[model samples]
Target chain A: MKRFIGFIRKEFYHIFRDRRSLFILFGMPIAQILLFGFAITNEINNVNIAILDHSKDTSTLEIINKISNSKYFSIKQIISREAEIESVFQKGKIKAVLNFEKDFGRNLIKKKSAQIQIITDATDPNTANSITNYINAILQNYLQEKNKSIQLDYQIIPQTRMVYNQELKSVFLFVPGVMTIILMLVSAMMTSISITREKELGTMEILLVSPLKPFQVIIGKVVPYIFLSIINAAVIVLLSIFIFKMPVEGSLILLGAESVLFIITSLALGILISTISDTQQSAMMISLMGLMLPVILLSGFIFPISSMPAPLQVISNIIPAKWFIIIIKGIMLKGVGLAFVWKETLILIGMTVFFIAVSVKKYKIRLD
Target chain B: MKNENVIEVENLTKAFGAFKAVNAISFEVKKGEIFGFLGANGAGKTTAIKMLIGISHPTSGKAKVVDFDVYTQPEAIKRNIGYMSQRFALYDDLTVQENINFFGGIYGLSRKAIRQKSKDSLVELGMHEISSKLVGSLPLGWKQKLSFSVALLHEPKIVFLDEPTGGVDPITRRQFWEMIYKAADQGTTIFVTTHYMDEAEYCDRVSIMVEGKIEALDTPKNLKQQFKVASMNEVFLKLARNIE
Candidate 1:
């Protein structure tokens, strides 16, 4: 145990002595949280748009006033001809164009329905999709008011509520994801690079040939990273809670426990990577390409797994971050208990055990 | 099986899927002798040293390092021996003092002992002023010397030096050999592997490996006399040329 402590002290020295890595370890989480919190938002405000109204009527003007007054959109131009719509969009100042068909108010009053085309530039599909949804809801509200005086028969009204995120704040969805990514990268990438660095510098051979057991050597190398990762997870959670106002409704202890489990899972993956890699460069490449990209792209951090294709969804199940994100979101947003997150917790535990077992076996083989 | 012998091997072999890397080699070293392991590149010198150091297991043979069985008692073997590898084995990011303390601590030395040893080593090497400096900032010769010193900090019965003097100047190499001789004089068996034939002359007994086998084993003088050469370099070349 004393020797193990010595080994860990050496590891801490290595980490603290390198300023670049220290920045990457502590600064990245805060920087990323701030960047993701204040920037990269889905909420739209003062969006530039063009209005094409064929009917110069009170009803058309009223609807335009409502859209511009909602603060979601700003009227950039009014085009008289349809040919001018294409040219306005070519300038790229406007993201959406609102078009009302000819005789819009006359038809809505006589026929009880009027067609309006919401033309949006799909160059950025996410922004376009949100813009269309917002406009559709506004039109629906206007129709509801219009039909309140006229008794329309056989009408079905659908009510939808965003349960966990009431205000639809994108930061609420991304805090857990960004925390997972930072923890994974720090624990896995840093540990793998550090271990492979020992191999490259021949210090690994010296440690292996010492009285330190292979298990001891590996644990010593990983313990410091586990502590660092937990600290990183805490900082990210605190930033999200205080700065971004993301709530942690469930037990903080359970959240912390699950985070430590995930950190161990990632550290085990790092040991597995170091066993397979002979140099620090190769270990870094494997950690970045094999671990980071998959965690970022396929772990439902930025994309929903349910909406993904079948094969990608199946592949995502193997990523521990997916389960961790689910667990964290449950605890933070839905205020779920351990009973609610037991399956994800079990999966993470199982993966941690499997990774550690495999890495130990591979490390022994390499030593022999 | 002599009481004074620190290393014992009998027909140790390591093979990698139909290719033998160390083909049935056997040798022994006494407690306080300087044993040189010489080979050309890929001549299995490293493979043999790795097995002896308890890192690599031999495919088929019996070997003991510092009286511990290499197979069953590798941990015991690890506790009794020190290893300095080819690539300057100290942590470059750590201070010289920290490196010494770290290595000393891992060998289960007491903190007081570590402090005393660090002081003695720094003063002995005339590097007391630079003990707090980062090892990476030091010159290559100093790093190699410090690595050797750290490897011996635990006062192990045997020390394995795998190409410890690869890229240093001749003066540093000579100084390094003097350190090795000083340790041997203190009754620590030294097993060193080197590609430099001139360095082999300083060893009490030298073994030259050719194609995964020990082609010649004798004193540098006896090997030269038996091979009818004036220098150890000619002796190594004559043995290497016979393989092709």
Candidate 2:
């Protein structure tokens, strides 16, 4: 145990002394969280929109005021001619164009219906759809308020509520995913490269020939990474809680335990990677290409796994990140206990065991 | 046991699929003897050394290193041996003192012992002033000598050096040999492999390998007289050329 502690101290010196690694380990996580929080958002806000109202009536003015008053849309341009609509959209800043028919208030009073066109730029389909939906919701609410006293037959109204994230904050979704990627990159990629570096420099031969057992040497190399990754996890959790107001509804202790388990699983994967790759470059390339894309796409971190094709869904089940994202989301957002996340917890444990077993076997084979 | 041999091998052969790298080679090195294993590149010297060190398994044969079977008691063999490879094997990012401390610690040395030994080793190398300097900043000769010292830090029974002086100058090589002699005089067996023919003369006994077989094995003077050559280099060339 004293030898192990000494080994860990050496590992820490390696990490803390390297300025580039220290920056990447600590600086990148906060930057990623802030960037993903503020920049890449699902909630539409202040979308530039153009208005083309042919009827200069009080009702059309009131409706336009309602659309612009809401936080979703900003009236960037008001075009008078019908031909200007296409050109305004071509400029591309205007995401949606609102056009009220001529004599809209007169038609609403006589026929109880008026035409309004919500033309959206379909190039960015998601954002365009969101802008159109926001406009429709605002119009529906206005009509309901205006006609509350008049009873009408066959009225249809839909009620919807965003269950888990009531505010639909993108940070809540991105924090967990970003945390997973950063931890995996830091723990697995860094460990693999460090180990392969020893091999390339010939220090590994000396280490193997020493009195230290192979397993002890491996554990020594990886233990410091576990501590660093835990510190990283805590930083991410604190950032999300204090800055983004993300909740930790479940037990904080369970969250910490699961994070450590994921970190170990990643570190084991790093050892397995180093065993297969003879050099640091190959280890890094394998970690990035082999692990990053799957974690991002199939882990339900950025993209929903259910939305992917069946084959991809099947393949995603093997990615450890998928299970970890579920575990974090359960603990942080849903506030679920161990019982609720036991399945994902078991999957992570199983993966950790599988990786350690494979690495140990490969390590033994190399010695032989 | 007073005449204990640090290394013993009998018909030790290693095969990868159909290709044999080291074939039916047997040798022994007595305690405190500088034994040289010489071969041209790809003559299976490395393969043989690896098996003897218990890092590689032999296809068919038995070997005992430091009185422990290479197959079943590899850990014991490892504990009793030190190794230096062709490449200088110190952590370039770590200071000299830290490298010594790390290696010593991995060998299960206590912290106090590691500190004392590190100080003593650096002073012996006349590098006590640069103890805190990163090893990457050290010259090649200094790095090689430090690596050798680090290998022997645990005081193992045998030190296997696989081409330990491949790229250094002759002066540094001579100095390294002196260190090897000093260690051997202290009762540490020096099992070394090298391509420098002149270095073969420094060994108490030498074995020349060709095509995975030991072509010649004897003292330098006996091999030269047997081959009727003026020098050990000529003898190695004659044997190597005859094998081809």
Candidate 3:
């Protein structure tokens, strides 16, 4: 027990003495949460738009005033000619244009129909789609209010409610994914680099020849990283809660337990990577390229796995982060219990065991 | 089978898929003797040492190190023996005192004993003032000596030095040999491998290996007389030239 404690102390010293790694260990989580929460958002606000009103009548003016009053759109310019619309779009500041056709009020009152064109910049297709949808929703609400007294022949209303995140806050989606990524990168990448450093420095031979068992050495090297990654997980969660007002509706103890399990899964992957790599550079490269990219891109962190092609969705099942993200989202957002996320939790546990078993087998084979 | 011998081997071999790295060979070393293991680059010196140190298992062989069988009692062998690799294995990021403390602790020494020993060893080397310095900042000669001292910290029965003095100045090499002799004098057996023929002259007995086989084993004077040469260097050349 004393020996193990000494080994852990040495590992702590190694981590604390390196200033750059220390910064990365503690600083990355808070920075990523803030960046993802505030900067990279899908919610639309104060989008610059132009209105081309050919009729210049009370009805067109009323619709224009309604659009401009909403928080989603800001009228930047009143385009006079059709030529001015293209020029304004070319300036790149205007996100969309609202054009009312000639005699729109007459058509609306007499024929109960009118034409309005919502031309949006499709270069950024996601924002363009969102902008068009928001405008359509606003127009539909206006039409309902204007036609409340008139009885229509057929009317179908679709009522929708967002269950987990009522506000559709993008931060709710990012906090869990970012937390998983941070934990994975810190635990797996750091441990692999540290193990391969000993190999490169030739200190691994001395360690192998020592009285310490191979398993003890590996466990000793990994324990410190587990502590560090857990602390980072806590910091990320707290920041998300305090700064972004994201809620953790489930039991905090279960959340902590799940985070630690994911941390262990990542550490086991680190051990496997170190066994395959002989140098720190190769270990780092393998962890980043083979692990990080897939976790970020294919684990439904940034892009939904269901929307991906069939094969990619199938491939995403192998990424451990996919299960973790689902588990975290279920617990934090949906306020679900173990009964809800037990399958994902079991999958994570199974993967952790498999990774550790394979790494141990590889390490034993290497000793001979 | 003699009780006086610390290391014994008979027909020891290691094969990597039909390519035999260390072919069948046999030798013995008495306790407290400086046995010099000399070989060419691919002559399997490292492979043999690895098996004897209990890091690598032999394919077919009978070997005993420090009264423990290599196949059955690798843990016992590891506990009873010490090894200094060619790279002078020491953690560069650790302080000099921390390295000693770590190795001593793993060897099951108590905290108070490690502190005392660390102080004594540093004082002996006249490096007590720099015990807190990072090992990476130390000079090559100081690091090599520190590594040797750490390997001997547990007072193991046998110490294996694999090319301990590969790239050092002659003065440092001489000092290193002086330390080796001091250890041997105190009843710790020294099994060393080296590429320098001059270092061969310092050993109590030397063996020359060529193509995974020991071609000659004798005192330096006898080897010179048998090969009809003036020095161990010429003797090594004569034996190397005769390889078919």
Candidate 4:
């Protein structure tokens, strides 16, 4: 136990002495949370769009005023002819164009329907889709306001309520994913790199020849990373709660325990990576490419799993981060306890055990 | 248990499929003997040393290190032996004192003992002033000597040095031999491998390996006389060339 403690103390020394790695371990979590919370957001605001109104009537003007008044759209240009619409779109600032047909007000009153074309630039499909949807919502609101007195005999309105994130705040979605990613990267990458560094420095040979058991050495390398990654988890949680005003509805202690488990899972992966790789560069590359890309893309962190193709959804099930994201979301957002997240918790524990077992089996006892 | 031979091997061999890296070679080292294991690079000097140190398994062998079977009691063998490889083994990022303490602690030394030994070793190396300096910043010779000292920190029964003086200056190499002699004087068996023929002279007994086989084994004077050469280098060349 003293030897293990000494080894861990030495690992801590290595971590603390390297300023760059220290920064990577502690600095990245807060920075990523802030960046994801504030900078890289999916929320649309002040989108530049052009207008083409042929009728120049009060109804068309009123619709245009309503669109511009909402924070979502800003009318950048008004075109007289349809020919100019393509040219304005080619200039590329305008993401959409609202085309009001000729005699729209008269047609609406006489035929009880009129054409209002929401022509959005499909170059950026997501924003274009959002722009089209926002215009449709605005038009629907206008119609509802105008038809307030004309009640239909049977009307069914779909009332939707966002359960966990009531405001639909993007930060609420990002904080959990960011925290998961930071914990994974820091725990897996740091432990793998530290282990491979011993191999690179040839200290592994001395260590292997020493009295220290191979598992003791591996665990010693991983313990410090677990401690640091937990601190990172805490930093991300604190940043999300304090800076972003995110809520933790479940037991904070349960959240902490789950984070530690995930951290161990990542650290086990790190030991496995170090077992296979011989150099620090390869260890780092394997961890970043092998772990990070999947956690980011396939874990449903950014993309919703339900919307993903069938095979990708199946693949996402294998990614531990997906389960972690689900677990934490259940905890922080849904305020569920272990009974709700026990299945995910079991999967994570199983993966952690498998990784540690594989690494132990793969860990070299001889320099063959 | 009171046997004079600290290391005993018979028909020890390590083969990778059909290629024998260390052929069926047999040897014995008396306690406190400085046994020089010499060979050309890739001649299995390292492979044999690794097997004896319990870091490499032998394909077919019978070996006893400190009365522990190489195959059955490698863990016990590991605890009773010290190893210094050609590669620099100390952590460069760690301070001088920290490396010593860590390795010392790895060998199950107590905290107070590690501190005392670290101070004494640093002072013996005349590096007490730079005990706080990172080992990476030290020169190559100093690093080699420091690693040797660190390897012996546990005071194991046998110390294995695999080409420990590969890149050191001649003066440092001389100092290294002196340290080996000093350790042997204190009744520690030294099993060392090297390519430098000049270093072969310092060993109490020497073995020349050529293509995984021990072509010759004797004291330096006896080897030179047996090969009808005036120097250990000529003896090695004669044996190596004849085998080739």
Scored by lDDT, the top model is 3
Q: What pairs collide in candidate 4?
A: none
Candidate chain B TM-scores, in order: 0.98, 0.98, 0.97, 0.97
Superposed Cα deviation of residue A238, candidate 1 (Å): 1.1
Tell me what TM-score chain B of candidate 1 gets against the true chain B.
0.98
Which ranges of candidate 1 are over 4 A from the true structure?
Answer: A56-58, A103-106, A144-166, B1-3
Superposed Cα deviation of residue A275, candidate 1 (Å): 0.9
Separate DockQ for every predicted complex: 0.85, 0.80, 0.82, 0.80
What TM-scores do the predictions have?
Answer: 0.95, 0.94, 0.95, 0.93
Q: Give interface RMSD (Å), model 3.
A: 0.9
Of 3 and 4, the candidate ranking higher by DockQ: 3
* Sort by lDDT, top down from the best: 3, 1, 2, 4
Give me candidate 1's TM-score against the actual structure. Answer: 0.95
Error of 2 at A291 (Å): 0.5
Q: In model 3, how large is the Cα lDDT of residue A21? A: 77
Off by over 4 Å in 4: A55-62, A102-113, A143-148, A152-168, A364-368, B1-3
lDDT of each: 0.89, 0.89, 0.90, 0.88
Look at candidate 2 and tell me the lDDT of residue B184.
92
Decreasing DockQ order of the candidates = 1, 3, 2, 4
